[model samples]
Target: MALNYDEIVGKFDKYIFNTYTRQPIAIKKACGAVVTDVNGKEYIDCVAGIAVNNVGHCHPAVVEAIKRQSEQLIHVYNLYYTEQQALLAEGLVNLTEMDRIFFCNSGAEAVEGALKLARKATGKKVFIATEHAFHGRTRGALSVTHKEKYRKPFEPLAPAVFVPYNDAGAIREAITNDTAGVILEPVQGEAGVIIPDDGYLGEIREICDETGTLMILDEVQTGFGRTGKWFAREHSGIKPDIMTLAKAMGGGFPMGAKLAREDVAANFGRGDHASTFGGNALSCAVALSNIEVIKKEKLVAKASDLGAYLMEELKALDKDYVKEVRGKGLMVGMELSIKCEDIVAKARECGVLLNCTSDSVLRFVPPLMISKEQLDTVVGVINEI
Candidate 1:
């Protein structure tokens, strides 16, 4: 028997916590860049699970890897050794310059681990974060996040200082001997895809060296080919002292990791920090396959080519509401002059799924494997709006 949208929504309202303002449609299934609702209406998925499905929803290789690993070994606590976990760590270390990888379950947990590592490594208590940055909602990650709406309710957060996103001078001025690290998103995702100046990250890297501050980058949304490179930091030719990753790493499964330089990571001894499900075999196997898919299919290059085309097409739109069109790779945003709540609703009604973040910016973080024809359809829908 087919369940109706009303029945699904009623169950959610009756049993689940009302945290998110969900769309009207009840999604029944997803494949590639499209999702089908209970009514069997298909919509082009531009949100891509908020940039979590970089290789598209349930890529065959990822699904196979998860199934194979699940049948062999689903999990063992971190106390036990697992070949899947060890292999995934090696893959991450080889992908970046970082020497050690600490696995967690989500981006927020990655950020939290990064913070604790920095403090332990530097013996400092203060951190410097950028304005409008959205690291995560956990208390440690929340402290460094800049949005007051998210932070105001959670008072007495970890000690931190907020500075303008792209201002090198402010970051330099904010740093003190007490500062353990400086954290920022390479491209602020929740702040409406705010891209920094070309040399901003490099400048911060130099300052961190001068002040002995660890440069921590929250690449939860911008990592794993979402930004044309393996990591967005590659665009600036800078290597952060610590990098936090999660979304897309698990190929639709839940996982996160914090990578750091050897000496920085050496500050912690065994049992200093741990997660029961952090390095589970299931997530590790799937993440390994996810990384393999990104490389084997050359999705990074695809994102670069298609992202450029999408940006150009969006910029060509003659809409009066458009204030700016900016982003890197598949993480694009169209800022509007006025509130865009109505625009989002209209897009959904027109068989397209879009996200409105920072109140007025229309965020389009579609799957990296989204087709040109699908993108054309998305643009046509936007044109009609």
Candidate 2:
């Protein structure tokens, strides 16, 4: 039995919670920078599952890893250690240069874990976050997230101070005796791909060290070759005290992790934090394979080269409405004087998928494997629009 678009939409309306502002077309399947709708029309996928499919959708390695792992073992509670989990932990620590790791299911769970670890390590209750930052939507993560609309309804959240981004002085002033940690995204993804000044992150690191506060870098959207490097922090050459990883971590499989220095990680005892489904055989296998594929394919270098190409092409486009074009690697954004909702719909109609963030910024986070020809077509379509 095949369901049409209306049928799927009707079912969602009747059965699903009304939260997401969904696009009209229902994607049937996706592969390597392209998605086919139920009606069989294909669109160049620029969104990349909101930057989740870094290795491209259903990459052979990831699919095979999932199949092989399922045959051996699908899932077991974290009570029993699994070889896959241990291997994945080692791989993550080596890649991230963090001393310890904690597994979880999604970006929000990772942020929640990082926040808890920060508080526990420093014995502090207050956190300082940057303005226009988006960590996650969970209660603890939401408290540090900077969007008022998301934070207003749930008042009396955990104590946190919001400071202007790219300003180390504001962070210094915000730190109090009860401050636990400071959390920030290396590149502000949801806020129009906002890239801070060259020395901003280093300044924050210095201030955090001076104040004895933990520095938590949220790499949920910017990790795993999305930003042309294994991790965005490499751009600054600073090691965060705590880091959150997800989004592309499992190559579309649900997985997240919180990593910290060894001493900071000691704050969490045996029973302090555990996820029932996290680090199970299947997720760990998928994540391990995802990392292997990223390394073997050399997608990091590909991202750096192609991202430069994409941004240059976009910059060449007529700038009558374009306010700015900026980003690092594959994480580029085009801010327009006009709102981007109508432009997004028009692009979708013209056989491309685009995401509008911060009301006016058109975010482009395509798969690292997207071809130059496909990206050229995407730019052509936007230019024609």
Candidate 3:
């Protein structure tokens, strides 16, 4: 039976909450760097589902793993353990020298869980976050998120102080005895993909060391080869005390995790915190496959090579409206002098899909599997748009 997208959209409008300003078309299926609408129109996917599909859409290995795991076991609470969960955890910790892993459900949940763990370790109530940072949308995560529109209505966010990112002095000034942790993104994702100064991460690590503050890096968007590395920290050579990850970990499945040093993890003991669906068989299975595919396919190295090529192509573009093109690896952003919301719509018309962050910067985080020729189409669309 063929599903009618318009009928489903009508039904969705009747039942779903009006929270997101979604695109009009419905994506029925996707493969590699392309997604097809309900009417079967093929569009080049440069957004990669907001950087969540680093391995590409409906990857054969990921789909097969999910299928195999579903037949093996679907759901089991955190009280019980599975080999998939162990493999996923091992894969995560192996990426970084971090000591422990705490499984969760989404990027926001990982942030909340990491916040709780940090507070417990320091026994402090205050936190220091960077200005223009977006941790997440949940109450706890929202409290740390610094956007006024997102934070205004929800007053009295967790007792947190916002400091200017990349300013080591402001961080030092803000960190007092009561400060529990300082959480930041290596490169700001939602804030127009802002990159910090050269020594920002190392400086933050130093400040945390001086103040006994837990340093947390929210690598939700920057993790899993999106920034051309296994993790963005690899570029800086500074390992964080705690790091949160999600988005691409499950290859489109709902999964998030927090990696922390063993000493720091000692604060959260048995029954300290657990998600009903965290570390479930299905999600872990998918994550295991996601990691394996990234490894076997060598998407991490591909991301680096392709990212540099894309950046060069974007930078080489001669557009009066383009102010700059900057980002690491596959995570490139072009800041335009003019508003670009319509670029999303216009790009789609040109048989390409893109995303705009803030009011002017266009973000490009295509799948790691995209070939250089496919990227040429994406770049050509942007130049024409």
Candidate 4:
């Protein structure tokens, strides 16, 4: 029996929460850089599950790891020791300079954990975040997020101060006695793939060191080879005190983690924090394979190479609507003079999938495995639009 697209959509309308104004496509299968709709129409995927499919959709290694782990153990909770969880932590710590890691289930949970750890470590109440920044939708993460529209409805959130991004002087001025930490995205994603100045991250690190303030980097969108490097902070040569990671970490499986230095992470007591489903065997196994695939397939360097090519091709195009093209690695964004929603719809009609953020910036975070030929098709479609 074939799947009923309209009936499935109707069921979603009646049963699911109306949180997302989703595109009218029922994706039923995906592999590498393409997705097939319920009706069997295939489209070249550029969103990569909003930057969560760094290893590409349904990577063989990741799928095998998940399947093998599921046959052995799926969930044992955090109370008991699990080999997969321990190995994942070791892998994360080895990849990053951080000494300890706390696993969770999503990017939002990681951000929330990082916030709590910062407050506990510094014994402070306030946090400074950048304007146009997006951490997560959870209350603690939402508190530091800078958008008025997302934070307005959930007013009276945790006390946080907001400042302009890419401005080191503002961050220095914002830090005070009550400031626990400063959190920022190495390259702002939701606000249109905004990359900061060369020395911005290093400057923030110096200021945090001078003021005894914890520095947190939200790498939810930029981690796991998305920004060419394993993490975007490597581009700036600065290691933050706390780093939040998710999105691509699980290789399409849901997972998140908050990493911190030894002394900083030690602030959390035995009863300080816990998650019922966090660090489960299934997610850990998949994440381990995800990292392994990235290393084995050399996807990081591939992303760097292909991202440059894509950006160059887009910039070289003589288009009136293109205002700017900027980003690092596979996380590129094309700013347009006109609204991009219609362009995205048109691209979908042309057998290409695209996403627009901040109304006018067309975000292109395709699978690292996307070929230059496939990218040419995407660029050709955009040029036509």
Which pairs of residues have clashing backbones in candidate 2? none
Off by over 4 Å in 4: none
Name every residue pair that clashes in candidate 3.
none
> Residue by residue across 1-385, what tens digits does model 2's lDDT show?
9899999999999999998999999999998899999999999999998889989999999999999999999888987889999999999999999999999999999999999999999999999999999999999999989999999999889999999888989999999999999999999999899999889899999999998999999999999998899999999899999999999999999999999999999999988888889888999999999999999999999999999999999999967999999989999999999999999999999999999999999999999999999999999999989
- Each candidate: what lDDT? 0.94, 0.94, 0.90, 0.95
Model 4 poorest 10 in a row by lDDT: 1-10
RMSD of each predicted structure: 0.9, 0.7, 1.1, 0.7
Report clashes for each candidate as comma-separated counts.
0, 0, 0, 0
After TM-score superposition, what is the CA distance of residue 234 in candidate 2 from its true location, in Å? 0.4
- Error at 128, model 4, angstroms: 0.2
- With a 3 Å backbone cut-off (N, CA, C), the pairs that clash in candidate 1 are none
- Name the better of 2 and 3 by lDDT: 2
* lDDT of predicted model 4: 0.95
- The candidate, 3 or 4, that scores higher on lDDT is 4
Report the poorest 10 consecutive residues by lDDT, candidate 1.
1-10
